[model samples]
Target: MIFKNISKSKLTLAFISIVITFFVWQQGLRDSLNRPSVTFDISQKEQEIAELSLQSIPVNLKKIFIINDPVDQINKSLSDVSFEELTERNKLIRIITSELNDPKIYKNISKDFENKNFKFLIDEIEKKSNNNSYKPSPDTFDLFKGDRFLYHLLSRKFDFDDSALITKSFSSKMFLKILAIRLIPLFTILIGSILALKILWTTIALKKFGWKEIKYLDLELIDMVLLIAGGFVVLGEVVSPLFSISLVELFSRNISNELSQSLKIFFGYLFMAIPPLGIVYYQIKSLNGEFNFKKDYLQFNFLPIKYAIIQGIKGWLTIVPFVLLISLIMNSLIDNQNGSNPLLEIVLNNNNYLSFFLLFLTTTLLAPLFEEIIFRGILLPTLSRNFGVISGIIISAFIFALAHLSLGEMPPLFVLGIGLGITRIASGSLFSSVIMHSLWNGLTFLNLFLLRT
Candidate 1:
């Protein structure tokens, strides 16, 4: 009767945990819907990259890429928009790209910007465009440093001696941007397609392509509820941040906003990890009656490191196409979808080296390690032991996606989680899933880095 009562109590607690987690996840997703999507930012970067490429790309390369005449393209983009609708930056780009023989164009753009320095720069550019001699000032030198291509073009018009030097520098930067923008997608699709076919063939042959049940440390359903709900959601996400943020606020008062924000994220993640990890440790100790790292822990087999790495690579490649397909479908179905993670915008816009490094560490290294340990290493195997392996993989992936609290991103993230779960089971190593997750995030980081001007 006591045993039955204990089981009933555990079941009731598990039910409560599910209800709380669901409510929290729903609120988070709803909140995310109000945030601006990252796709807009990505589009802006693409436009910037394209504009810069047109300025310095070789004529032969432009022909190969089928890039249209940049002046015509810029005119088309600005055609329907009135002067008031155009941003200050867009106005500057338009004025720089235009033939300044039109006096109205010069007056309209220069008069709208109230800043004397901005007006002065516009006036000089107009003079240079019209073959009227204008003395170069320190602001012009700053412009030369800030935007070498714009400076080089203006210098060529004014017949400045340093135009050739600026041209060389501008060309090198444009080459890298163009190469990265064009090659990254092609490389991903090609590798992904090859791996996708291999995965299909392996599935048909019934050979090493599915999630397999593994013998893991004994854990009850209530233990999972305690770890995920009490430890992760309640303590890690909620309670722990209270302390972490307080500490960061105390120490980072004198720092720049960017640096302070970075510290908060870094320390916040560390603190959040502690409670769940502590729970894991405690549960392991309780279950085994003693802690033996090698014998009584999640599987992180690294003996065949090469095989694990290869499997991880293969899993990442195979999943890329599926995830991309889901993202495309979502985009097609939803217009201006919100709920992109705000971290993406921070990474894209951050100029400070120290802050960027901290973010890089959090995303590429720490996130993969901690997330894989929790989801695939522990949660997956425990769930798999209770349910069927396939059910376990799906359920765990769903939970993983929910934990991210992004509605727009959940489908792709869920797909990616499934891939990680499959990799974890098929390779029989938590190390493989960790590698795959790291590679996924590292690729995103690299893309964002390349997009930086």
Candidate 2:
């Protein structure tokens, strides 16, 4: 009906919609540039209560031979040695003290002494206790105390600067988790508003919009296809360029870097490449006639796959502007003890523009593919099944935010989570969610590159 009402005069309105979308995206990127990528969960599970040390003792006295000889026998042979003599080697002192306190020293590590390997230490301790002359030699006791000091010293940890991991609620870091719950729904509303506006604008243009988005956000088959295809293109064009197969140092900061990199690679193969080529490996056994839930969810008919992708892009173009607007607002508000901005640091963090580009590609492309598989594909279906669709969307969105571990997630992240979930449900396809998720992240990457610079 709107199209029937349109004339050449309306064509100008269509161009205006696209320009508005780009402006909003650029603004959001500028704001998000300074935001930090999350590294840990913000749930108020266990307060640090006290700082823990990470530096191990400076000494390497992991082993020393102290035989079970009598106190009189030991005292006579080592008469010239005083209590101070035992501590000559710091490592030796550590070993002696750790052994003296049976629980503190060998207790944790003893389990790892593979191949029936731990009997020697167990036997020595047991044998000493069995003998009547087990007076606990004075020099050995001194050695034990010194080692305890070293154990505590070497385990020094980074000062838990609550500043490094703060969420920007009106209150301090202590109450961030509580505020997050309340904020989740509000963020959903804001994101939904932005998406709706973008959708209307896209409709006015010739870009094509989706079917009436399920008011509650359920993706039809077509929605899924479009999301996957657009997201995949962005990933292939932007993300694949970040590959650094030979560089190890780039990943040094990542704890599960190797395993994560491998999984990312696997997903990249599945979604970004020609489908069923890899996905079919699962289906070859049952590909003949029956298409069950397993097949419906996992298997693909190329026609539907291609159709769905076209739909997803049309849907995304309409809604993308709103996503960009919220993201910009989310990124702009700053949080840091050192007053560091993630946006500024993007370039400063990587002296090599190539590395920065790699970071950009990975964030925009790779993360969305894997994340969608987990969140929209795996998590949303699982959660929606557990708690009706609405509950699933809320909880899945929360988990999405929590999944991204880092200090900087306090802002638009929760909103992004909700957006990702809604997009998946609305399209009734994981691809829709992937497009939205990648768009959100890609905007941030652009923030780092375009705005922060």
Candidate 3:
């Protein structure tokens, strides 16, 4: 360990770095609490899926996927006192409830709306409620052409003659997307619950489920702290972004805004990874002057590639239920919980294929690789050596979650980090944890892609 020979200056530097990281990260977390969440967008897409399935898919399949009247549920979701809020969710709730001639909903439509088409729809709904028989113009359908799903919802209300044709026009492509959206989470959670229960049983009865500690690095706790707090946070996140953003801005002046944003994220991540990883490389080199790259540092252990993949898959499957359960609890407890990563909204709203592809590479590939290396490959093993395996796992996971600077998402992310930590130690392979992190992110990206409809 470097503890015996550690200089006072190095320890002081580590202390200062950790304090700076804490304060800055705390401020970031506080700021994140006020940031808008993507939950509303996700809810809207799920509701659209339910509404579309009702109109397009077979009754049996629809029944299997959608359990209740989606519009009725939307109506129930509306706050009695917050009807005057001009949010997108409020507008949707009013539109859905207007079919039932809700007097309260009509009263709230006095607020001005920027969308002329939506304003016209509200006007038509009002006229219909008053028994005016004021028919919507033929161009009314064309007005909502940009949002085909919303067009379908209003078609039934207006009794459009082409409603049947439109319902029948549901493409096989859309059906598959909807199917994946509905089935993937359901199946993942189901399998995860079973696997989690089995793992619990083994832990309690057989005592065969636990992390096995291994010292992967000959570094002290201060070294680990400095690597993460100083190298990763200060250099990688703060300093690297300054350069990466400038580089991207200088060269991307002629590109589309979406493409520019995507490029910034991709290259920014690559740049950010460089300093911390470089520090790790130098630290390894310093420790073992004539070291073998593969064996002497960060036991990737990919000789048994299939084993790593399977262990990763198992870790992912086992972790889903716990993480999702935390998410569900948080959502129920906090209305409109914020601090959703801005990248989620970007991915959801992005229409350009190139932009989307770049984003996919950033999230599903680069993020997993870099994060696993820092948190699992380096931090976890060192902490385990200092504090024992279980404390090491919890503390590392807490730091991992805190590093995201998203307070609303912290609980679930902490749960996810725990799963990654356990997987790293139990599998005895950093490659397994990387694969697990990649799978977790890849599934989230896939869901977002499917929800774009």
Candidate 4:
């Protein structure tokens, strides 16, 4: 009874953990996506265009082209019909290829080509240069237009916004805009910091962490045990639902609508199932240890993420972005219970909400723990005892991935499995693998429950 109760308690905790994590995660998403922010970029671009157009001479609008739409003006005056305003515009793309034959025409219209007419400007700019390139775009008002091609002619006088001579190209103002956007990738680096902490804990208990308690997590059995147990759990996870659905269907006297989600879900589970079996077989063949069954039974402390956050990033560590980003996409694919199976349908979908909740718990907590134990803990150890480390890790990782039901989610999961296995091997403890496994699952649940569209 105690053992059964403990098992039930653990499962209950796992389930509750998913629910709580999801709520917090969704709140974070709502805050991030729906926050009201003031941005004046569009208005700024409009103002710049207005200034250029008002000028009697044709002012260069290309400098602001990075953010602003192109103009199809014929001369310095008149806001007549522009080519960009047209709906069916196919000839615009040809300028880069077919239009290359046109001769340099923009001559003595303004500055170097002080041509008063558009044709004259084209004639001058189109003149053959030593570079063997210089084609006049035959289309008038092509400059600074909405088209993807050079909507307008490139002017030497436009002048580089910043270092026109040093970098040879890329205006300073434009460069800054690009730099700002690219900085978003920095989010991943923050994730890397967390991963780094995990590595450290895999080795030493976070001394600078919560109360600095000596928490040495043994990792020796993680990979091999995980390899076997993870595989078996994955099979069970996939198979149980299938059997449930089939049995329900077999009771054809009255078929419930819930069967709809079951069929596709079966595919989802199938996607996960095939991969883990191979991993276990490979591991069993590799390791020759007098099978240590009791030691291989996986166990790990439930990480209070609060503690994980502080201790995980305090040491020499980097947060992993792969799982986070994947979680982001996965979260987008699901919601608290939006994309759930129809068994929830049989229970008027209130059960759906419950099932959805349960699904989160299972995927995030239960799946990760047992799966990691079977694949990384058991199988990997078995393989290493016989074949060696490299082969064991690879085989187990592959099996871990193949065991997933969602085929689309497989590639990323495989990569994650490998990382988990590697960490387990390095730390020589199952705890490290469990942490990684839990982290991956938690992130996915967070994405789904916490951050929804």
Candidate 5:
């Protein structure tokens, strides 16, 4: 039990890490949650003035005023405007309404002028005209009847400028601060939970199994090929069409988008789970009908329930950092390539409540169970028996990652596969890997859920 003694020392270190992680997380969370709220009291007049000063006049107004080529002049005047100068309403009006009297430009001004300011300015011109030659168009005021800006101005309601607020909230430094506040605490807690479980399992495994009773499977090359092929056929071709229109039609006569999506995912999970479970049963039967449900069949015999939880935690913690790093690298590469991960796109875009629930259930529960049975339960031990432990784990992990058929996702999936492989070997139970897989998927689902919300 030299290995067990080493495990005990590792367990103590993991426990200390967990304690420190939690302390830091708690403090960060407290600070973030207790930050003061922001409030704004922008008045209607201020908003209206800001909008008029900032926004360019309508194209129709430019055509009418014969200012079709004044882009430079207008930009220069806007840039040079001071608060003191802007306070003079008459001067501000003159600056905005320049070049309205040229004959070439006036010829372009038709009765169809649609600018909001046109009617008001025309009325003023008519009042000042001694010859009474110009008249305001009857239809000019019709365009502003239900306008949002006019309604806001008339109502005199106080509101914050949304663009300004958004810009302020997402300034680079502020954004990074917020991200650190939220992410660090969350990751710390997750890792702490995993380490705590590992410590508990080390103590329990030492007492119960004494490291000798752990079972291993002997898998042939043919078994590996068949398992891999069967998995691809089921998950890729068979389960993929669960979202097809024809499949949705089979579920109900009147299928809404949500219902259709839910049924698709539901059937998808069923297809994924049944075939793998059958494979697992066949594998168990091939073992001379010797079934130790906990150790041999289910792979849950490394320790009692109390210590077994540690294996699950260790598996997840092992994969998380690798997954995160791979994800970051993949995202950067994808950005450079100007491409997207289709599976991620689908998960992100599909936000229906029932659809989300179905997706969550499939990924977190069904996927973990079936995938673990195939990869960890059947493949890992089999490969280990044929090859050395390290080679077997690496090979199995590679296959597991490749099964997803996503270049962007492969690295992280491989990392996850390695973690699960290690868990299966260390704990001597497939169930432990399954728990770890489930927790990892559950966390991924939760992260997506929070982001969408």
Candidate 6:
């Protein structure tokens, strides 16, 4: 009966995964179709023209003064100016001055050439050229202009080119690309969810079949508090200082900024991982023979691979909506803040592959392994035993969120911690929670990568 139930659940999950994959593929196709056909080449040419016209102003103005009709004279002067001569600032100035003098051409002038001082000059030219009898339309002059506004405008236009290129590059093979990008995290989530359910089912079945009561080491409340506090101090006081200031100063003196930064991140996390693991080991050792190697210590027990994977997927599914909601709210509230994880910022900004690899390793692998052991393996269980399950989960989860020291991120982190705690209890193994945490970080890393590319 249990086998039949498990088989049915697997089929349902497979169907859901297939449906989601199809939906994502369809959306990607729709996005590609709606993408703009425009390219950066047109904008680049316009910028060149604006620069050339600005430089040719003086020469064209001379022609404008010699002719009765400034519009025809300026147009003829512009047509004569060679592209090579446009590189000279003086020639560019002449061309721009000629364009401003002609009402018809000036009306269609690029906003790049319209500046406060330039407009004042144009008004002065009109007063002198027409003897205050004829005036160009007010629309030809920009009211609000700044220094080097043209350069700024060019930069802004160039920024959208990356996204435009991505849209244009989409093909029939896009489904394969999307699947490849998302596959690892999707599998991790699915397997984790399944493992969690299987573990719960197994525990219930065993209890009904007269399984013996599980026993844990007799840890005092003070013992739990001390261990937690010790880990925090080691991370905050010992590891943080080395990374934040000392290592940076030391490395800056000896190496390039890029190498120094990479070394700092690698060594910082290395040091951070050691101390917590050492502390946990020490605490377990202090329990003497009372600590059951297989069952009492959550980290020591090996959950069935299938059950572990299912739990991870379930935990991720439970927390994803809350994580997304908090992320949206936080982003809206702190819109000015760069919407990037610090580790992600380092990964994206640095060109050094070694540095990128080190950063990724620290965040995705080492951080998850050590943190899950400390929080879920040690803290959550200890707290649950001392303070009852609900209070322990809530309290430990709150501390986990607080440790991040980000108000904007606290809500999401807190929710994630709760999910991890629930998985710890349901699966009765630290490994399940570790898998979930790693998968969550992996998903976030992938998200940032997509946004950047």
Question: Tens digit of lDDT per residue, candidate 6, span 1-453?
Answer: 112233555455445544543454345434433432111112222232232233233554534322233323333544554634332322333444443445434333323343545455434444534453544443323331221222222222222222222222332133233334445546655655675576568768887422212234455554444455444443433455566667667646866676678777777766666655676667677667444555546553454778877766677766775566676686577533321234554554465667667767777788888788778777776777767777878998987876554444567888889888877776666777888898788776564443222
- Please give the range of 10 consecutive residues that has the lowest summed lDDT in model 6: 36-45
Give one digit per residue, the lDDT tens place, for model 1 in 65-168: 53565445655565545757665655665666666576557777787897675676677777765666665653455545564444544554455655444465
Off by more than 4 A, model 3: 75-131, 140-143, 161-175, 204-215, 290-296
C-alpha lDDT score of every prediction, in listed order: 0.78, 0.41, 0.81, 0.42, 0.53, 0.54
Cα error, candidate 1, residue 152 (Å): 8.6
Between candidates 3 and 5, the one scoring higher on lDDT is: 3
Worst 10 residues of 5 by lDDT: 36-45
Regions of candidate 1 where Cα sits further than 4 Å from its true position:
1-20, 64-166, 207-213
Question: Evaluated with TM-score, which candidate comes out highest?
Answer: 3
Which candidate, 2 or 6, would have the higher lDDT against the true structure? 6
State the lDDT of candidate 5 residue by residue for 1-453, as single tens digits: 112233455455445544543454345434433431110011112223233223333445434322323333433443454534332332323333443444333223323345536544344443423333544443433443343333222222112233332243333333343344346536755775676476569768777422223355554555454445543344334554555546667766675676576666667667556655665567667765755555456565645875667778776776676677776686566532211233333454466777777787778778887888777777777777667678878999987876554444567788889878877777776778888999887775554443331
Q: Residue by residue across 76-159, what tens digits does model 4's lDDT show?
A: 111222434311222121121123443432222223322244343344434533134544443433343432123322322121
Instruction: Flag the better candidate by lDDT, 4 or 6.
Output: 6
lDDT score for candidate 6 against the true structure: 0.54
How would the candidate models be sorted by TM-score, starting from the highest?
3, 1, 5, 6, 4, 2
Residue 392 in candidate 5, Cα distance off native in Å: 0.9
TM-score of each candidate structure, all chains considered together: 0.82, 0.36, 0.87, 0.37, 0.54, 0.53
Poorest stretch of ten by lDDT in candidate 3: 164-173
Candidate 5 — which residues are off by over 4 angstroms?
A: 1-181, 184-186, 189-214, 231-247, 289-295, 331-343
TM-score for candidate 2: 0.36
- Cα miss at 305, model 5 (Å)? 1.9
Off by over 4 Å in 2: 1-296, 299-344, 347-353, 407-411
lDDT of 1 at 154: 50
- In terms of lDDT, the best-performing candidate is 3
- Compute the lDDT of residue 96 as modeled in candidate 4: 19
